[model samples]
Target: MELHHKLRRDPSWHPNACNICGQLGHQAVNCTNGTINWRQIYGDEAFTIKPPVFWSEMADKQKKKEVDVKELARRAREYARMQCQAQGIDYDEMIRGAQVFQHAPEQKPQLPVTSQQNGGSAGGAVKKEAPEGDLPEGWAVARDAQQRVYYWHKKTQKVQWDKPTKDTPVS
Candidate 1:
């Protein structure tokens, strides 16, 4: 039997609608109202028999999102590299320091604060702490050959690999 003949019409036999042009009677794949014709619209080289109106829309959105994310990530990496170079430190070392911050808890880690030798201000005696848990994923605490510990700071937009001081060696 023919496919249409074997099928029985129901009270809700509403025809398929086209997602692109918002037309009824025929689905987007079989639409012939000139709104979307795969062969003519995309050309023979890009034409495909398989309908991908929904999938293509989703894929396009995903591709755009990925592009935006990659651009942002590239900018951040470049800024980090530049900051590390200015401080006479390895860029990779700074990245490793960011890892330590990533795995730590929400609360900022406490380090000893020393008063300014110039006797600037009492507030200068307290060292401001970095914000907690804002680093990229897959980061870990690592040190360079100099055994310096890296730390991430939002204010400077840098990952600092602090050298061991005379009072606090092996930081």
Candidate 2:
């Protein structure tokens, strides 16, 4: 039998054609035919091709209403309060914690370098600065208050603060 006949006989065989341009080989949905002939589709002779309006252009043309910042904030607080009550948590504490993170300044720490001549390790014994405040579960110490440093932990799970000391060996 022929290759096309064999393919047709296959259970998974599907016809491929560009729906927009009426072209073969490619699927219909992803047709790159930019020219949308509305007249051809609708059979309306009055219809003509017009320049496509981008999402941004359409948004720009729309009349925007001024938003009240204070009102929006009040509504957001009310919503948050309801959510917190549903989840059984302090709303004020959650807001305060969020504010602390929002207002906190960004800090980056420099790694300590060791001198080879001083008999020190090649990559200096880097001492990790202690965390400033007791953050909530899953939250990490972004900035240390004592040495004024920042650290990032990719894990979203909560870590035990009072675990093994720095002297403890890792298995």
Best by TM-score: 2
Give the TM-score of each candidate: 0.23, 0.29
> Each candidate: RMSD to true structure?
20.0, 16.5
Over 4 Å off, model 2? 1-60, 65-74, 113-171
Which 10-residue span in candidate 2 carries the lowest summed lDDT?
144-153
Give lDDT per model, in order.
Answer: 0.53, 0.54
Q: For model 2, how does the per-residue alpha-carbon lDDT over 31-57 read when each residue is reduced to its tens digit? A: 456365544566753545677889987
Clash-forming residue pairs, model 1: none
Using lDDT as the measure, the top candidate is 2
Model 2: colliding residue pairs: none
Q: For candidate 1, lDDT tens digit of each residue in 89-151?
A: 898876788899899879655454443431343443332343335444332334333333344
> Could you tell me how far off, in angstroms, the CA of residue 130 lies in candidate 1 after the best superposition?
34
